[model samples]
Target chain A: MSETKKLMYVNRKAPYGTIYAWESLEVVLIGAAFEQDVSVAFVDDGVYQLCKDQDTTGLGIKNFSATYKALGDYDVNKLYIEKESLEARGLTLDDLMPLVYEDEDDDWAEKDSIKVVSSQEMAELFEQSDVLFNF
Target chain B: MKLSIQVNEGPYNHEASVSALNYTKAALEAGHEIFRVFFYHDGVNNGTRYTTPPQDDINIANSWSELADKHGLDLVVCVAAAQRRGIVDEGEQERNGKDGNNIAPGFRISGLGQLIEAGIQSERLVVFGD
Candidate 1:
């Protein structure tokens, strides 16, 4: 078996407007299938991707937010959200989907856990990963 | 590590620019050099200096300029994409009979060589699309 490498996936697009967001999620899933240690970070408008309620039917787009909930099943649970992004959007921790972790939470106490982080901290996540994918 | 970063969305149109910036910062922080950052399709809009987002909104063009200023990062915009979008540098402006160059301060209009170079230079090349 090939040695597993750590990878970080950064999602920065909203869910419905473009294919970037969904494509990024697909990449994460592919990485996980390879047994790579995959982590995903949602920043900027990408935070909208994890909103508790997403209805893409009206937009004629498939709803992929549910796929995010399945990340855990693939062990791709190192999901992150930017603290400032949430606030700028007038969204709070509770407004997001349950899979996300805020920067303040203890759940991400471990170095390997998926957690929310500041912009500065996000830089660190990139530094640590063997591969960094931005989508 | 060979780093090939593909930026697909336009500047300020979404968070892809910020993510690209953050990814660049992280790559540099990790002591790794960036191979190349390729701006394609709508991503070519990122190379324009003429953009002015609302004061309250984040300035992606400025963010990209800062990255180039601080790190000397190579920002490459696909010429075909740029031309189609009406984004050209001074030389192109003269050749195409355009009024002026709209490219951002730090960006350079180049061909796919830069993209190929990025793929060969970085250990991992990631694509950020919109």
Candidate 2:
């Protein structure tokens, strides 16, 4: 039963404003150990968590945004960023960190982990998941 | 289908609990089996029996207590979170050497393992938070 279920972590808040973003990442890191089919969705202000060059030194935070780059190593690489959210916030994919993983199926080629999906696709993704984690 | 709900925010402070309650009620009305309600973080505050809201407002804790009593749903507050928040049952009070217990009726103090167990046992795990 370990890898049989579809687990989705739905992030709807911005990073740094509250502890939810950091704590959610903590859960994602721990959940990776369970070896489940983990997928993360960046909706609303959640996309900010992956923004490039997050300077948290002034805020006195650890600046854990870089940890998203390592999610591929844990085999939790499916990151769906809502297109509407990004557009509304006037952000493009170029504004975020480049996260890619080696595609084991294709001669160990590289594959991008960040996927820009429509809101409808996001809803379908939610429909297909066994678990919906929002914080 | 069996559904497990995780509430991560405290009552009154956030609409997470209220949304969870509504979604849960809707799920039950739609003939879904609720496996458990796992309260974590400040969410455990929803289980404190001492929460006395004004007459003008709804008592969220009591709402959950009544729902549990009516449907026999398991309402579990995480022990680690509850201990930090001072939400204790009689057993917990005895174990922690505390003078009093404030665990609301129809709710029990448990561990984070209960949340994992729910995820494994139920068909769906729906989380609500701020």
Candidate 3:
């Protein structure tokens, strides 16, 4: 393992419509083993990746939304969703899955996964990333 | 500066690989070190050695192979993406009971981790996709 450099998985596509969102999550899970400082950002249409009440049963696809919830278990807790994207889509924080992680330093406190940020803030996060995986 | 490039589209059908190749050539000409070129999704289709474009069209696979050979570059096609898209190397073909391999010269099939490794080792990770 090398240094724990910051990695950002930029999700700018809608899930299910294409394989990009699903495959991007796969990379995030595999990359977890490397112990890199990984953060997932949902921008553009990518914000839909975390949309709540997703039902893929009718589409003959395995519902992978739960996997996003499980990302916290993999120690990938940082998820940033662009506030502008949500607003443009007429979606609020209520429209997304409730993702959270246990904050051990804060005495095992739970934290929200959706760290909503403005588009400019998202750009800052992008600048901080050593590797930006755009899928 | 050390750089890593990722291509997300296949040859002929899309311009992503072409742009990536051009960017890489310019980078190298400007004395930038390209740590690796990792092809993902449809981009893995660029590694097929069996591609034979018409007399007028450029063969994208050969272009990548030539560029890689010229610079001793690591050209890796994501194995998971490749297998899903029917692109295979010699070992992959044998393991999967396929009859042949279509991996181009100077290109190898690898996992997504190779892309991550390239990202870790390089200063920038540039992506070219549809």
Candidate 4:
């Protein structure tokens, strides 16, 4: 209602091993409807969520990985990946899905939304957020 | 300070629900204003009256019900999550054609927007779970 408040949705779990990741994504999708300043942070096992080639066919579970791509359309552009988390998981930005959003203010130019930041920078982001929803 | 609470885990299986209850009770006793308590994920299980633990153990949902009644707290169980887990109220029961509703007293089924609203309105938002 008031001017947008900075909201950080912190994900710390793997996408499939538990329900946290999927539910967190649901919250983000719903929260996006509110038109608030939103940021999604992937830390620890949460980093696995963005890994490309996610195959859930054998698992017989609904694969929600592709939903992350749709986030751009919701105006939820900021996706922060902790550098340490990716390294610990032996993943690089190259291993992640290339998520991009169109810049409406700049003639709809496409730009990358994923930003690999250090843990310190993640902490600074934590401080910068008006509210934090952890999953 | 005005605060909001989020519970992400189910009762008994994890200590999170009870811990949230304790923390909320403490906060209320300390004279802090609780803007809302939004239950999501498996946390919606905390709103069901179907939980029947050992007689010696605590009834987590009842504890929350009693607390909400006493403090006039807003205990909101997310509708989407609740429907998934089958924690329904009378309205949900009628709409979903459920045989009966299991929502406990003082707990209401609502949308995730309640959570976003809590984050926007509260001075502090506390989360309890992994």
- Which candidate number maximizes DockQ? 4
Question: What is the full ranking by TM-score, best candidate first?
Answer: 4, 3, 2, 1
- Candidate 4, A1-135: lDDT as tens digits: 867899999999999978999999999999999989999999999999999999999999999999999999999999999999999989999999999999999999999999999999999999999999999
True contacts kept of each: 0.27, 0.32, 0.59, 0.86
Off by over 4 Å in 4: none
Question: Each model's TM-score, in the order given?
Answer: 0.52, 0.75, 0.95, 0.98
State the lDDT at B4 in candidate 4: 98
Give the clashing pairs for model 2. Answer: none
**Tens-digit lDDT track for model 1 on A39-81?**
7888999999988888877888678888887776676667878
DockQ of 4: 0.90
Which numbered prediction scores highest in TM-score against the true structure? 4
Residue B61 accuracy (lDDT) in model 3: 92
Q: Which of the two candidates, 1 or 2, achieves a greater TM-score against the reference? A: 2
Q: Which ranges of candidate 2 are over 4 A from the true structure?
A: A106-110, B18-32, B54-59, B62-72, B78-120, B126-130
Indicate the worst ten consecutive residues by lDDT in candidate 1 chain B: B112-121
Docking class of 4: high
lDDT of 2 by residue, A100-124 (tens): 8888888978899999999999999
Candidate 3: segments with Cα more than 4 A from true spot: none
lDDT of 4 by residue, B56-117 (tens): 99999999999999999999999999999999899999999999999999999999999999
> In what order do the candidates fall by DockQ, top score first?
4, 3, 2, 1
